[model samples]
Every structure is written in structure tokens, then in C-alpha cells.
Target: MLEPRLRTMWLANAASGAAAVAVRTPRPVFADRTRTPRETVVASDLELVTVTDHSAVLTWTTRARNRAGRLRPVPADTEVRITSADSRGAPRTWFFEGLRTPYHYAEIRGLEPGRSYRFEAYSDGRRAVPARTLVTRRSGTPESTGVFTTATPPPGRLIRTIALANDLHYGEPASGLFAGLFEGVRHGTDEYPEFMLHALLEDLRLPDRAADHLVVAGDLTDSGTAEQALGVRAQLDDWGELGRDYFVCRGNHDVRPPDETDHWGNVFHPRDRLLEYFAGGLRIIGLDTTRVRGAGGTLAPAQLAQLGELLRGEPERPTLIFGHHPVTRHAAVSNPGGPGFVLDRANAAALHRLYASAPGVFLHHSGHTHRNRRSRPDSGIGVEFLEVGAVKEYPGGYTLIRIYEGGYMVNFWKTRSESARRWSTRTRSQYLGLHPDHALGSCADRNHVVLRDFSGLSG
Candidate 1:
């Protein structure tokens, strides 16, 4: 959603071997046919996808630098050398043996919590630079250089787990296309959207990483075309049954041109009404924050009234509301973004007021900003507004929410599959080498534990 989408006229990219199509009127939808597929920048570095009380997932990709401003993927054996930071034990190395692929992932487990461990990655036995230590601390200390803490899961019985994701942007063939950010970047050979989503689905399908349910926040399309929308939906259909195993909300790009022929609107947001569902004692709500041909968001007076009434009816039931646009001013102003980046002040204030009254509403999640951030506009309002990073690009992944009897935990994980890791690594130079700084949030923002009273909720 950070990219420029041409309106009224389409621009062709012969480099991508595609012709652009022209459109008309207040077109806020995606210009899917006009995008330039090849990225012109490239970078490669090892990263900590995520760390936990007992395990850590480290991933990276190898690339061959290019003087012509595009790097090609290079195969290299993957390995990670790890040891106790204190040097109290013999060092160990783990590997994805027998594979010389561009993408690499090494998972280390069985470490003690509240302790630190030193680790480094190797490409074909060559040590990766800037070796760092992983501090799996539970002491509630602040994060420091090269050392991040684990996700402090709540102390109690875990009842339900939800996979939180947004901005799939299916049908788009490339990423990091917003500005001249493409300078020196290299786009993935595979269709970027499908590549990312495939990795997500595969990761979520793993036994140890599965979730009880899934929530796709919004932007489920590159442009509001029937083929694009249906394609994304069909892929998701393989994940599980819609409206039961998973749910979706619409985004600005998902909005089609105001034409009766556009079936994408009918396919997804027929009524633009709030979607209410449940997983045991937890209540899930999906709000449609977008309007036709508009980039920002709104909560109509009638919709607000309805939401207030619904919350009042179940004042103490734990609830989570999600949408495409951030709802709180703290979230809106947390980063340097343009107008229409969030909900207008009026609707935000109204939602905050409702949250102040409904003690059960704990979180409001959004994804347009494509960053992992948490905010509370008013401490007294009792709602945490969270903006999760996009699934289609750099730092590509989803947020996992584990609701416990006592409270909840939030942790973000980067997709570790071959195509995803390669694409993610190559896109770091986006926005002129500043994309990582803006998209990759601080450790605290990506992982945290919040205590709340949820005695009434149980699986």
C-alpha cells in the first residue's frame, strides 16, 4: 500500500514485458497491470526471525551483487554456530545439510530462559558478519544492541491462538515500488505475493506452529479485479473454510472503481457491515474501515452506535476488533506518514470513548502502515491499538496472538521459507535503504506481554 498507484491512465513497463491498462474516475484501486516487476536493488544479511523462551529461528539469504543494480540469488550451504555467551560449554553448529539454496533457516532450541546465548550464521562455512548474542531474558529488562528478549507469555493456561495478518496484496508481481526506492533492489523471480502467502500457509500448517484460527486484517488484493480477488480467495480456501476457520476484512486497495461490472466489491464487502464471530469465550470483530475511492478510513455514526450497543450487551466478554486503518491517534502519529494514513480524529475519538465504556475490548489491530507498533491514545481508554507489518514484503510475516486465562502475548515472526527469505532479504534497500528501519520495528514492539483480567474467557 506504500506504492504509488496511477489513476485514470496506466503506464506500461516494457522492462517487465507488460502493458498497462487505462481506467476512469476517482480510482483509488490498484493499477495491477502497470507495475514494473524487476527490482533494481539487492542486499543480504542474517536475521533473527523470532526468539522464544526455549527456541529461536534464524534465517537469511545469499545473493550475488550486481553492478547493474540487480542481484541474483546464489545457492550456499546454511549453518549456525551457537554457544552459551558465557563460554561455559562447547559450541555447536546446526545446519540445513544437503541443501545449497539461497534461503536458509536454522532453529535452535532447548535453551534456558532468562539467559543469553551467542550465535552466528555461516554461508558455505564462511562466517557471517557482526556476530551477536541472543538474550532470552525474562527479567523484564529493556532491550539493547544485538540482544533481544523472548516473548513473555502470560502465566496461566493458554486457551486460544489466532494468526493475525494483513496486506496480502495478491496479484502484485513486485514490491518496494513506492518511490525511487527501487534503486539497486532486486525483485523475486517467483510471483512475490503468492510466494509470501505460500510460505505463510506452509509455516502455519506446521504442527508446532499452528494456530486455532486465522484473521486476515485487509488489502487481500493488488487491485480490485475479479481475477485477482478470486485468486487470493481460492488460495485461502485451501487453508481452511471461510467464516469458520478464518475471516477477512476489506482495505482501500480492495475497493473497486464505482462500476456495476466490478464484482470484486460484491465478492468481498457486499454490505460493508461489521463481521462478528467467536472462538470459545473470545469475541472477534472485523470492521470495514474503507470507503469507495478513498484511501483513509471512517466509522459511520450508525455503525458506531451499533458497535456501542453490541459491546454493551456483552460488556465483560473479551473482544478484539480489527480493520485496515489504524484507529487511535497514538498509532497514527507514531510514525512519519502522510494524510489518510489512519482514521480521522472524530471516528478515533468515538471508538476510544466506546472502549472506555466496554472493559472487555482489549485490542484493535490494523495493517495499512505495514509496521509492528502498539499504542494507547489514552491510557484510561483501556484499548491497545496494534499495527502489524505486511505479509507481502520485507520482514514478511504475521503476528501470533495467544490468549491465556490471565492475559495475552503478542509475537511477530518473519516468514522463513526459501522464496520468502530471499525476497525479504533482497528488499531491505527499499525506500532508499531506510525500509528496514521503518518496517522492522523494535524488539519491544514485535514481542510483548500485557496483563489483563480475562477470567471469563476459556477455550
Candidate 2:
């Protein structure tokens, strides 16, 4: 069957004759075989793209005109009229601004969590699309939106379990590479990166699976703007106390724009070189590998020496290192040259040498490639160099680190909230229209266990 957007258009009989007509608000008009007539206001693709406890995204497409068959520009003041699906409350309207094409998108906020909602699209105060039903996804589901919840949140004064997310790209304009290069791409359909991060934060704080601590490895923002950096921190603040409950390091995108002053003020300055925090018997080290705007990462000689010293100080203690770029390469679609996808070979080798001798270190996590992958360093480092997909776009999620007396394990938990999954699935198109599973990664990327004696670490 044809999709909803396509089905919205119909061949209605005309008063003058049985001419092929596409439905329009006032009346049906001639159906352009090569293009959608300007009067054809709506087509099939109307559907909910994502839903969180308090927010949801809806998108649709309209008919186009001209020989090129380009989408007719969407009418200004297009909005989504939303109300409780059960009609328990008054309706609210969400609007879009600065939109340019036939694709219509809007995000509805201020909704109640776990509540169902009904919404319809309108253009210039006229109904542009039919009403649809949506249910806000529950928080903390294990695998999918309707599945089981994760393990219970541990009590205070227990072994600290930290949640890990990287490559949030808070101010990223588009969710995927070449986002605007294709005509199939819908304008403003994807959720804002900040919204995606907000949903991920909700997952981090879910009951029974609450993270005692949170660590963002790198690439917190797309261009390291003050607004993006501050936006990232603001979202984290909504989760818990910063420094005490959470910490973040920089990615290549998080580098300051090489200016003395920023629009968001000095608090948004990018000077977090590295962070070392202790959780129970685990030493978590976050390294800033971004060396000012280069796509790949490089450690300054000073930072490298500092890392060596930090590792040598307590080689017997358990340690987990994280950065924005991977130390080892993985099988992925994009294979760029230089230090673009993975860390500099020399830097990775040097770090591998350090960890190989430092028995305390067992895992090295990074995120920049925006895909899940796992590989042990080639130099026999005994450490898992794992790269996680982006949390701001497809495969939205974070890694859950559970420390036990005998050992620790890392699991990649996809942000399963309905909104997260929808955006994740939708943005998979940004991966060059590849299958969702291609960007989602395999089971090996989801769960892994390593047995090692970590009894010496404090619980």
C-alpha cells in the first residue's frame, strides 16, 4: 500500500469533468503527474517521529510544483495542534519558524510523561493533515520502549555506578552527515540535539538504574560554542550536581573557537584539559584529545606525560580511561585518512604502551565515529578500546558501567524512550540512508564482561 503521505492525496471527480484531482482544502485541483500541484497541500508521510515523557516530534510532507518537482515551500505559521489523547485538558499549539520546504515538522513540549496525545498539523490556520495518536514512551526500559526496566538504582554509599555518553554535539545543526544534501531529507523533522540529550539524561536517572555518577567522554558540543557548551552543562544540571555527580571532557568539536571572549561568557570557556575522579575502587580518567579544530585527536606532550605519571602512580588500582577519539580502528562505512576517524597512530601507540604496563587499566572508551565498535589494542594492552555511537542522534544512549568486587562490566543502553527511538530511527538516514541496524551496531557492541580482581577498590 502507498504510504500515508501519498495516500492523503486522492483523485476526486471534478464538477466540469472526471479530471485527475489532488485533494486541497477549498477544492481538489488537477493532479500534476510530474509534480504535486500547488493546491495539493498534504501527502502521506504524516507520522510521529519521536516521543519522550514531556516532548514529541511530528513530521509530514506536502505537494511540490515546478519542473524540477521540488517541494512547494511550506506556508509560514505552520503549527501542530496537540491535545491530550483522552481529552483531559485543553489543546496546546506548537509552531515552527524559519522553515523553507514542503516538509513540515514541529516539536511539542510541556506534555506529561507516559501520557497519550493527539495532534494535527495546520498551515495558515487551515488543517494541513489529519489527526494522529501518540503515546509518550516510559522511561528506563531495558531494550525497547515497552520492554523491562534496567537493574534498580543502587543505594547511597555503595559501589558508584557511572553512566557514560559522548559525542552529544549539543548545538549540532543537523543530526547526521550531509543532512541537507538530499531532497529526501525532511526539513526540521529531527529533534534538536538538546532535546535528545535531555531524554538521555532522563534515562540516566531512571529508578533501579540510576547512575551514581555520569561521565561525558567528549564532543559535548558541535562547535564548542558558548551556547552549545553551556547548553550541554544546563542539561547535565537538570540531571544532578555537576563536578560532584557528573563530569565532562572535551572532544575536537568542544574546542573553544580560539577567541578570548565568547558570547555565552567565561563560564562557557573550554579549558577542561582532563578530569580524574575516583568511584569506589575505580579510577575514571577523562582526557581531552582535541587539539584545536583538527578532526582527529592528538595529546599534547604535556598531557601525555601527565597521563603516564597518573597511570604509574597506582598501577595496581582499577582504572578506566575515556576520550573522544578511539585508540583502535573499527569496521565502519567511512574510512577517512589522517587522524580523522581514530586517534593519531603515534598517540594511540604511546597510550597503548602505557596501559599495557599499567595492570590497573582495563578499558578505554571513546566516541566520535558515531557508531558502536569494540576492539582490543593491537599492542597487547589488555584493554578494550570501545567506541560508542553518538547520544545526540541515532543509537541515542549511554554506556552503563557496573563495578563488582570480582570485576566490572560495560553495557551500551540505547535510550529506549519512545521519543529517543523515533529520532534515532529517523536520523539513521543521516548515515547515508543505510539500514538502521547498520548504524545501531551488533550485540557485541551492546554488552561485554571482563573478569579481573578489583576487590581492593572501595565500595
Those runs of model 2 whose alpha carbons end farther than 4 Å from true positions after fitting are 1-158, 179-191, 259-272, 329-339, 435-438
The 10 consecutive residues of candidate 1 with the worst lDDT sum are 1-10
Q: Please give me the total number of clashing residue pairs in predicted model 1.
A: 6
Q: In candidate 2, how many Å is residue 341 off?
A: 2.6
Alpha carbon lDDT at 82, candidate 2: 54
User: 20-42, model 1: which lDDT tens digit per residue?
Assistant: 11211111211133434243222
Could you give candidate 2's per-residue lDDT for residues 1-459 as a string of tens digits? 222221221111111112111211112222124543345454423434444334444554455354676644343334565554566644444333333345454544444544555565655444554212111122322111222111222223235577878888777766555435544333284446776787677666555356888877788777767777677777788777766677777777776666545332244324536667776667888887776556767788878898999999988778888887777744222433334657777887798789977998988888877766776566766787777778887667777777766656566666644455556656645545552444444444555555666667676
What is candidate 1's local distance difference test score? 0.70
For model 1 the TM-score comes to: 0.81
CA lDDT of each prediction against the hidden true structure: 0.70, 0.59
In model 2, pairs of residues that clash are 4-44, 5-43, 5-44, 5-45, 6-44, 51-419, 151-208, 152-208, 153-208, 281-457
lDDT assessment of candidate 2: 0.59
Looking at model 2, report the run of 10 residues with the lowest lDDT sum.
Answer: 11-20
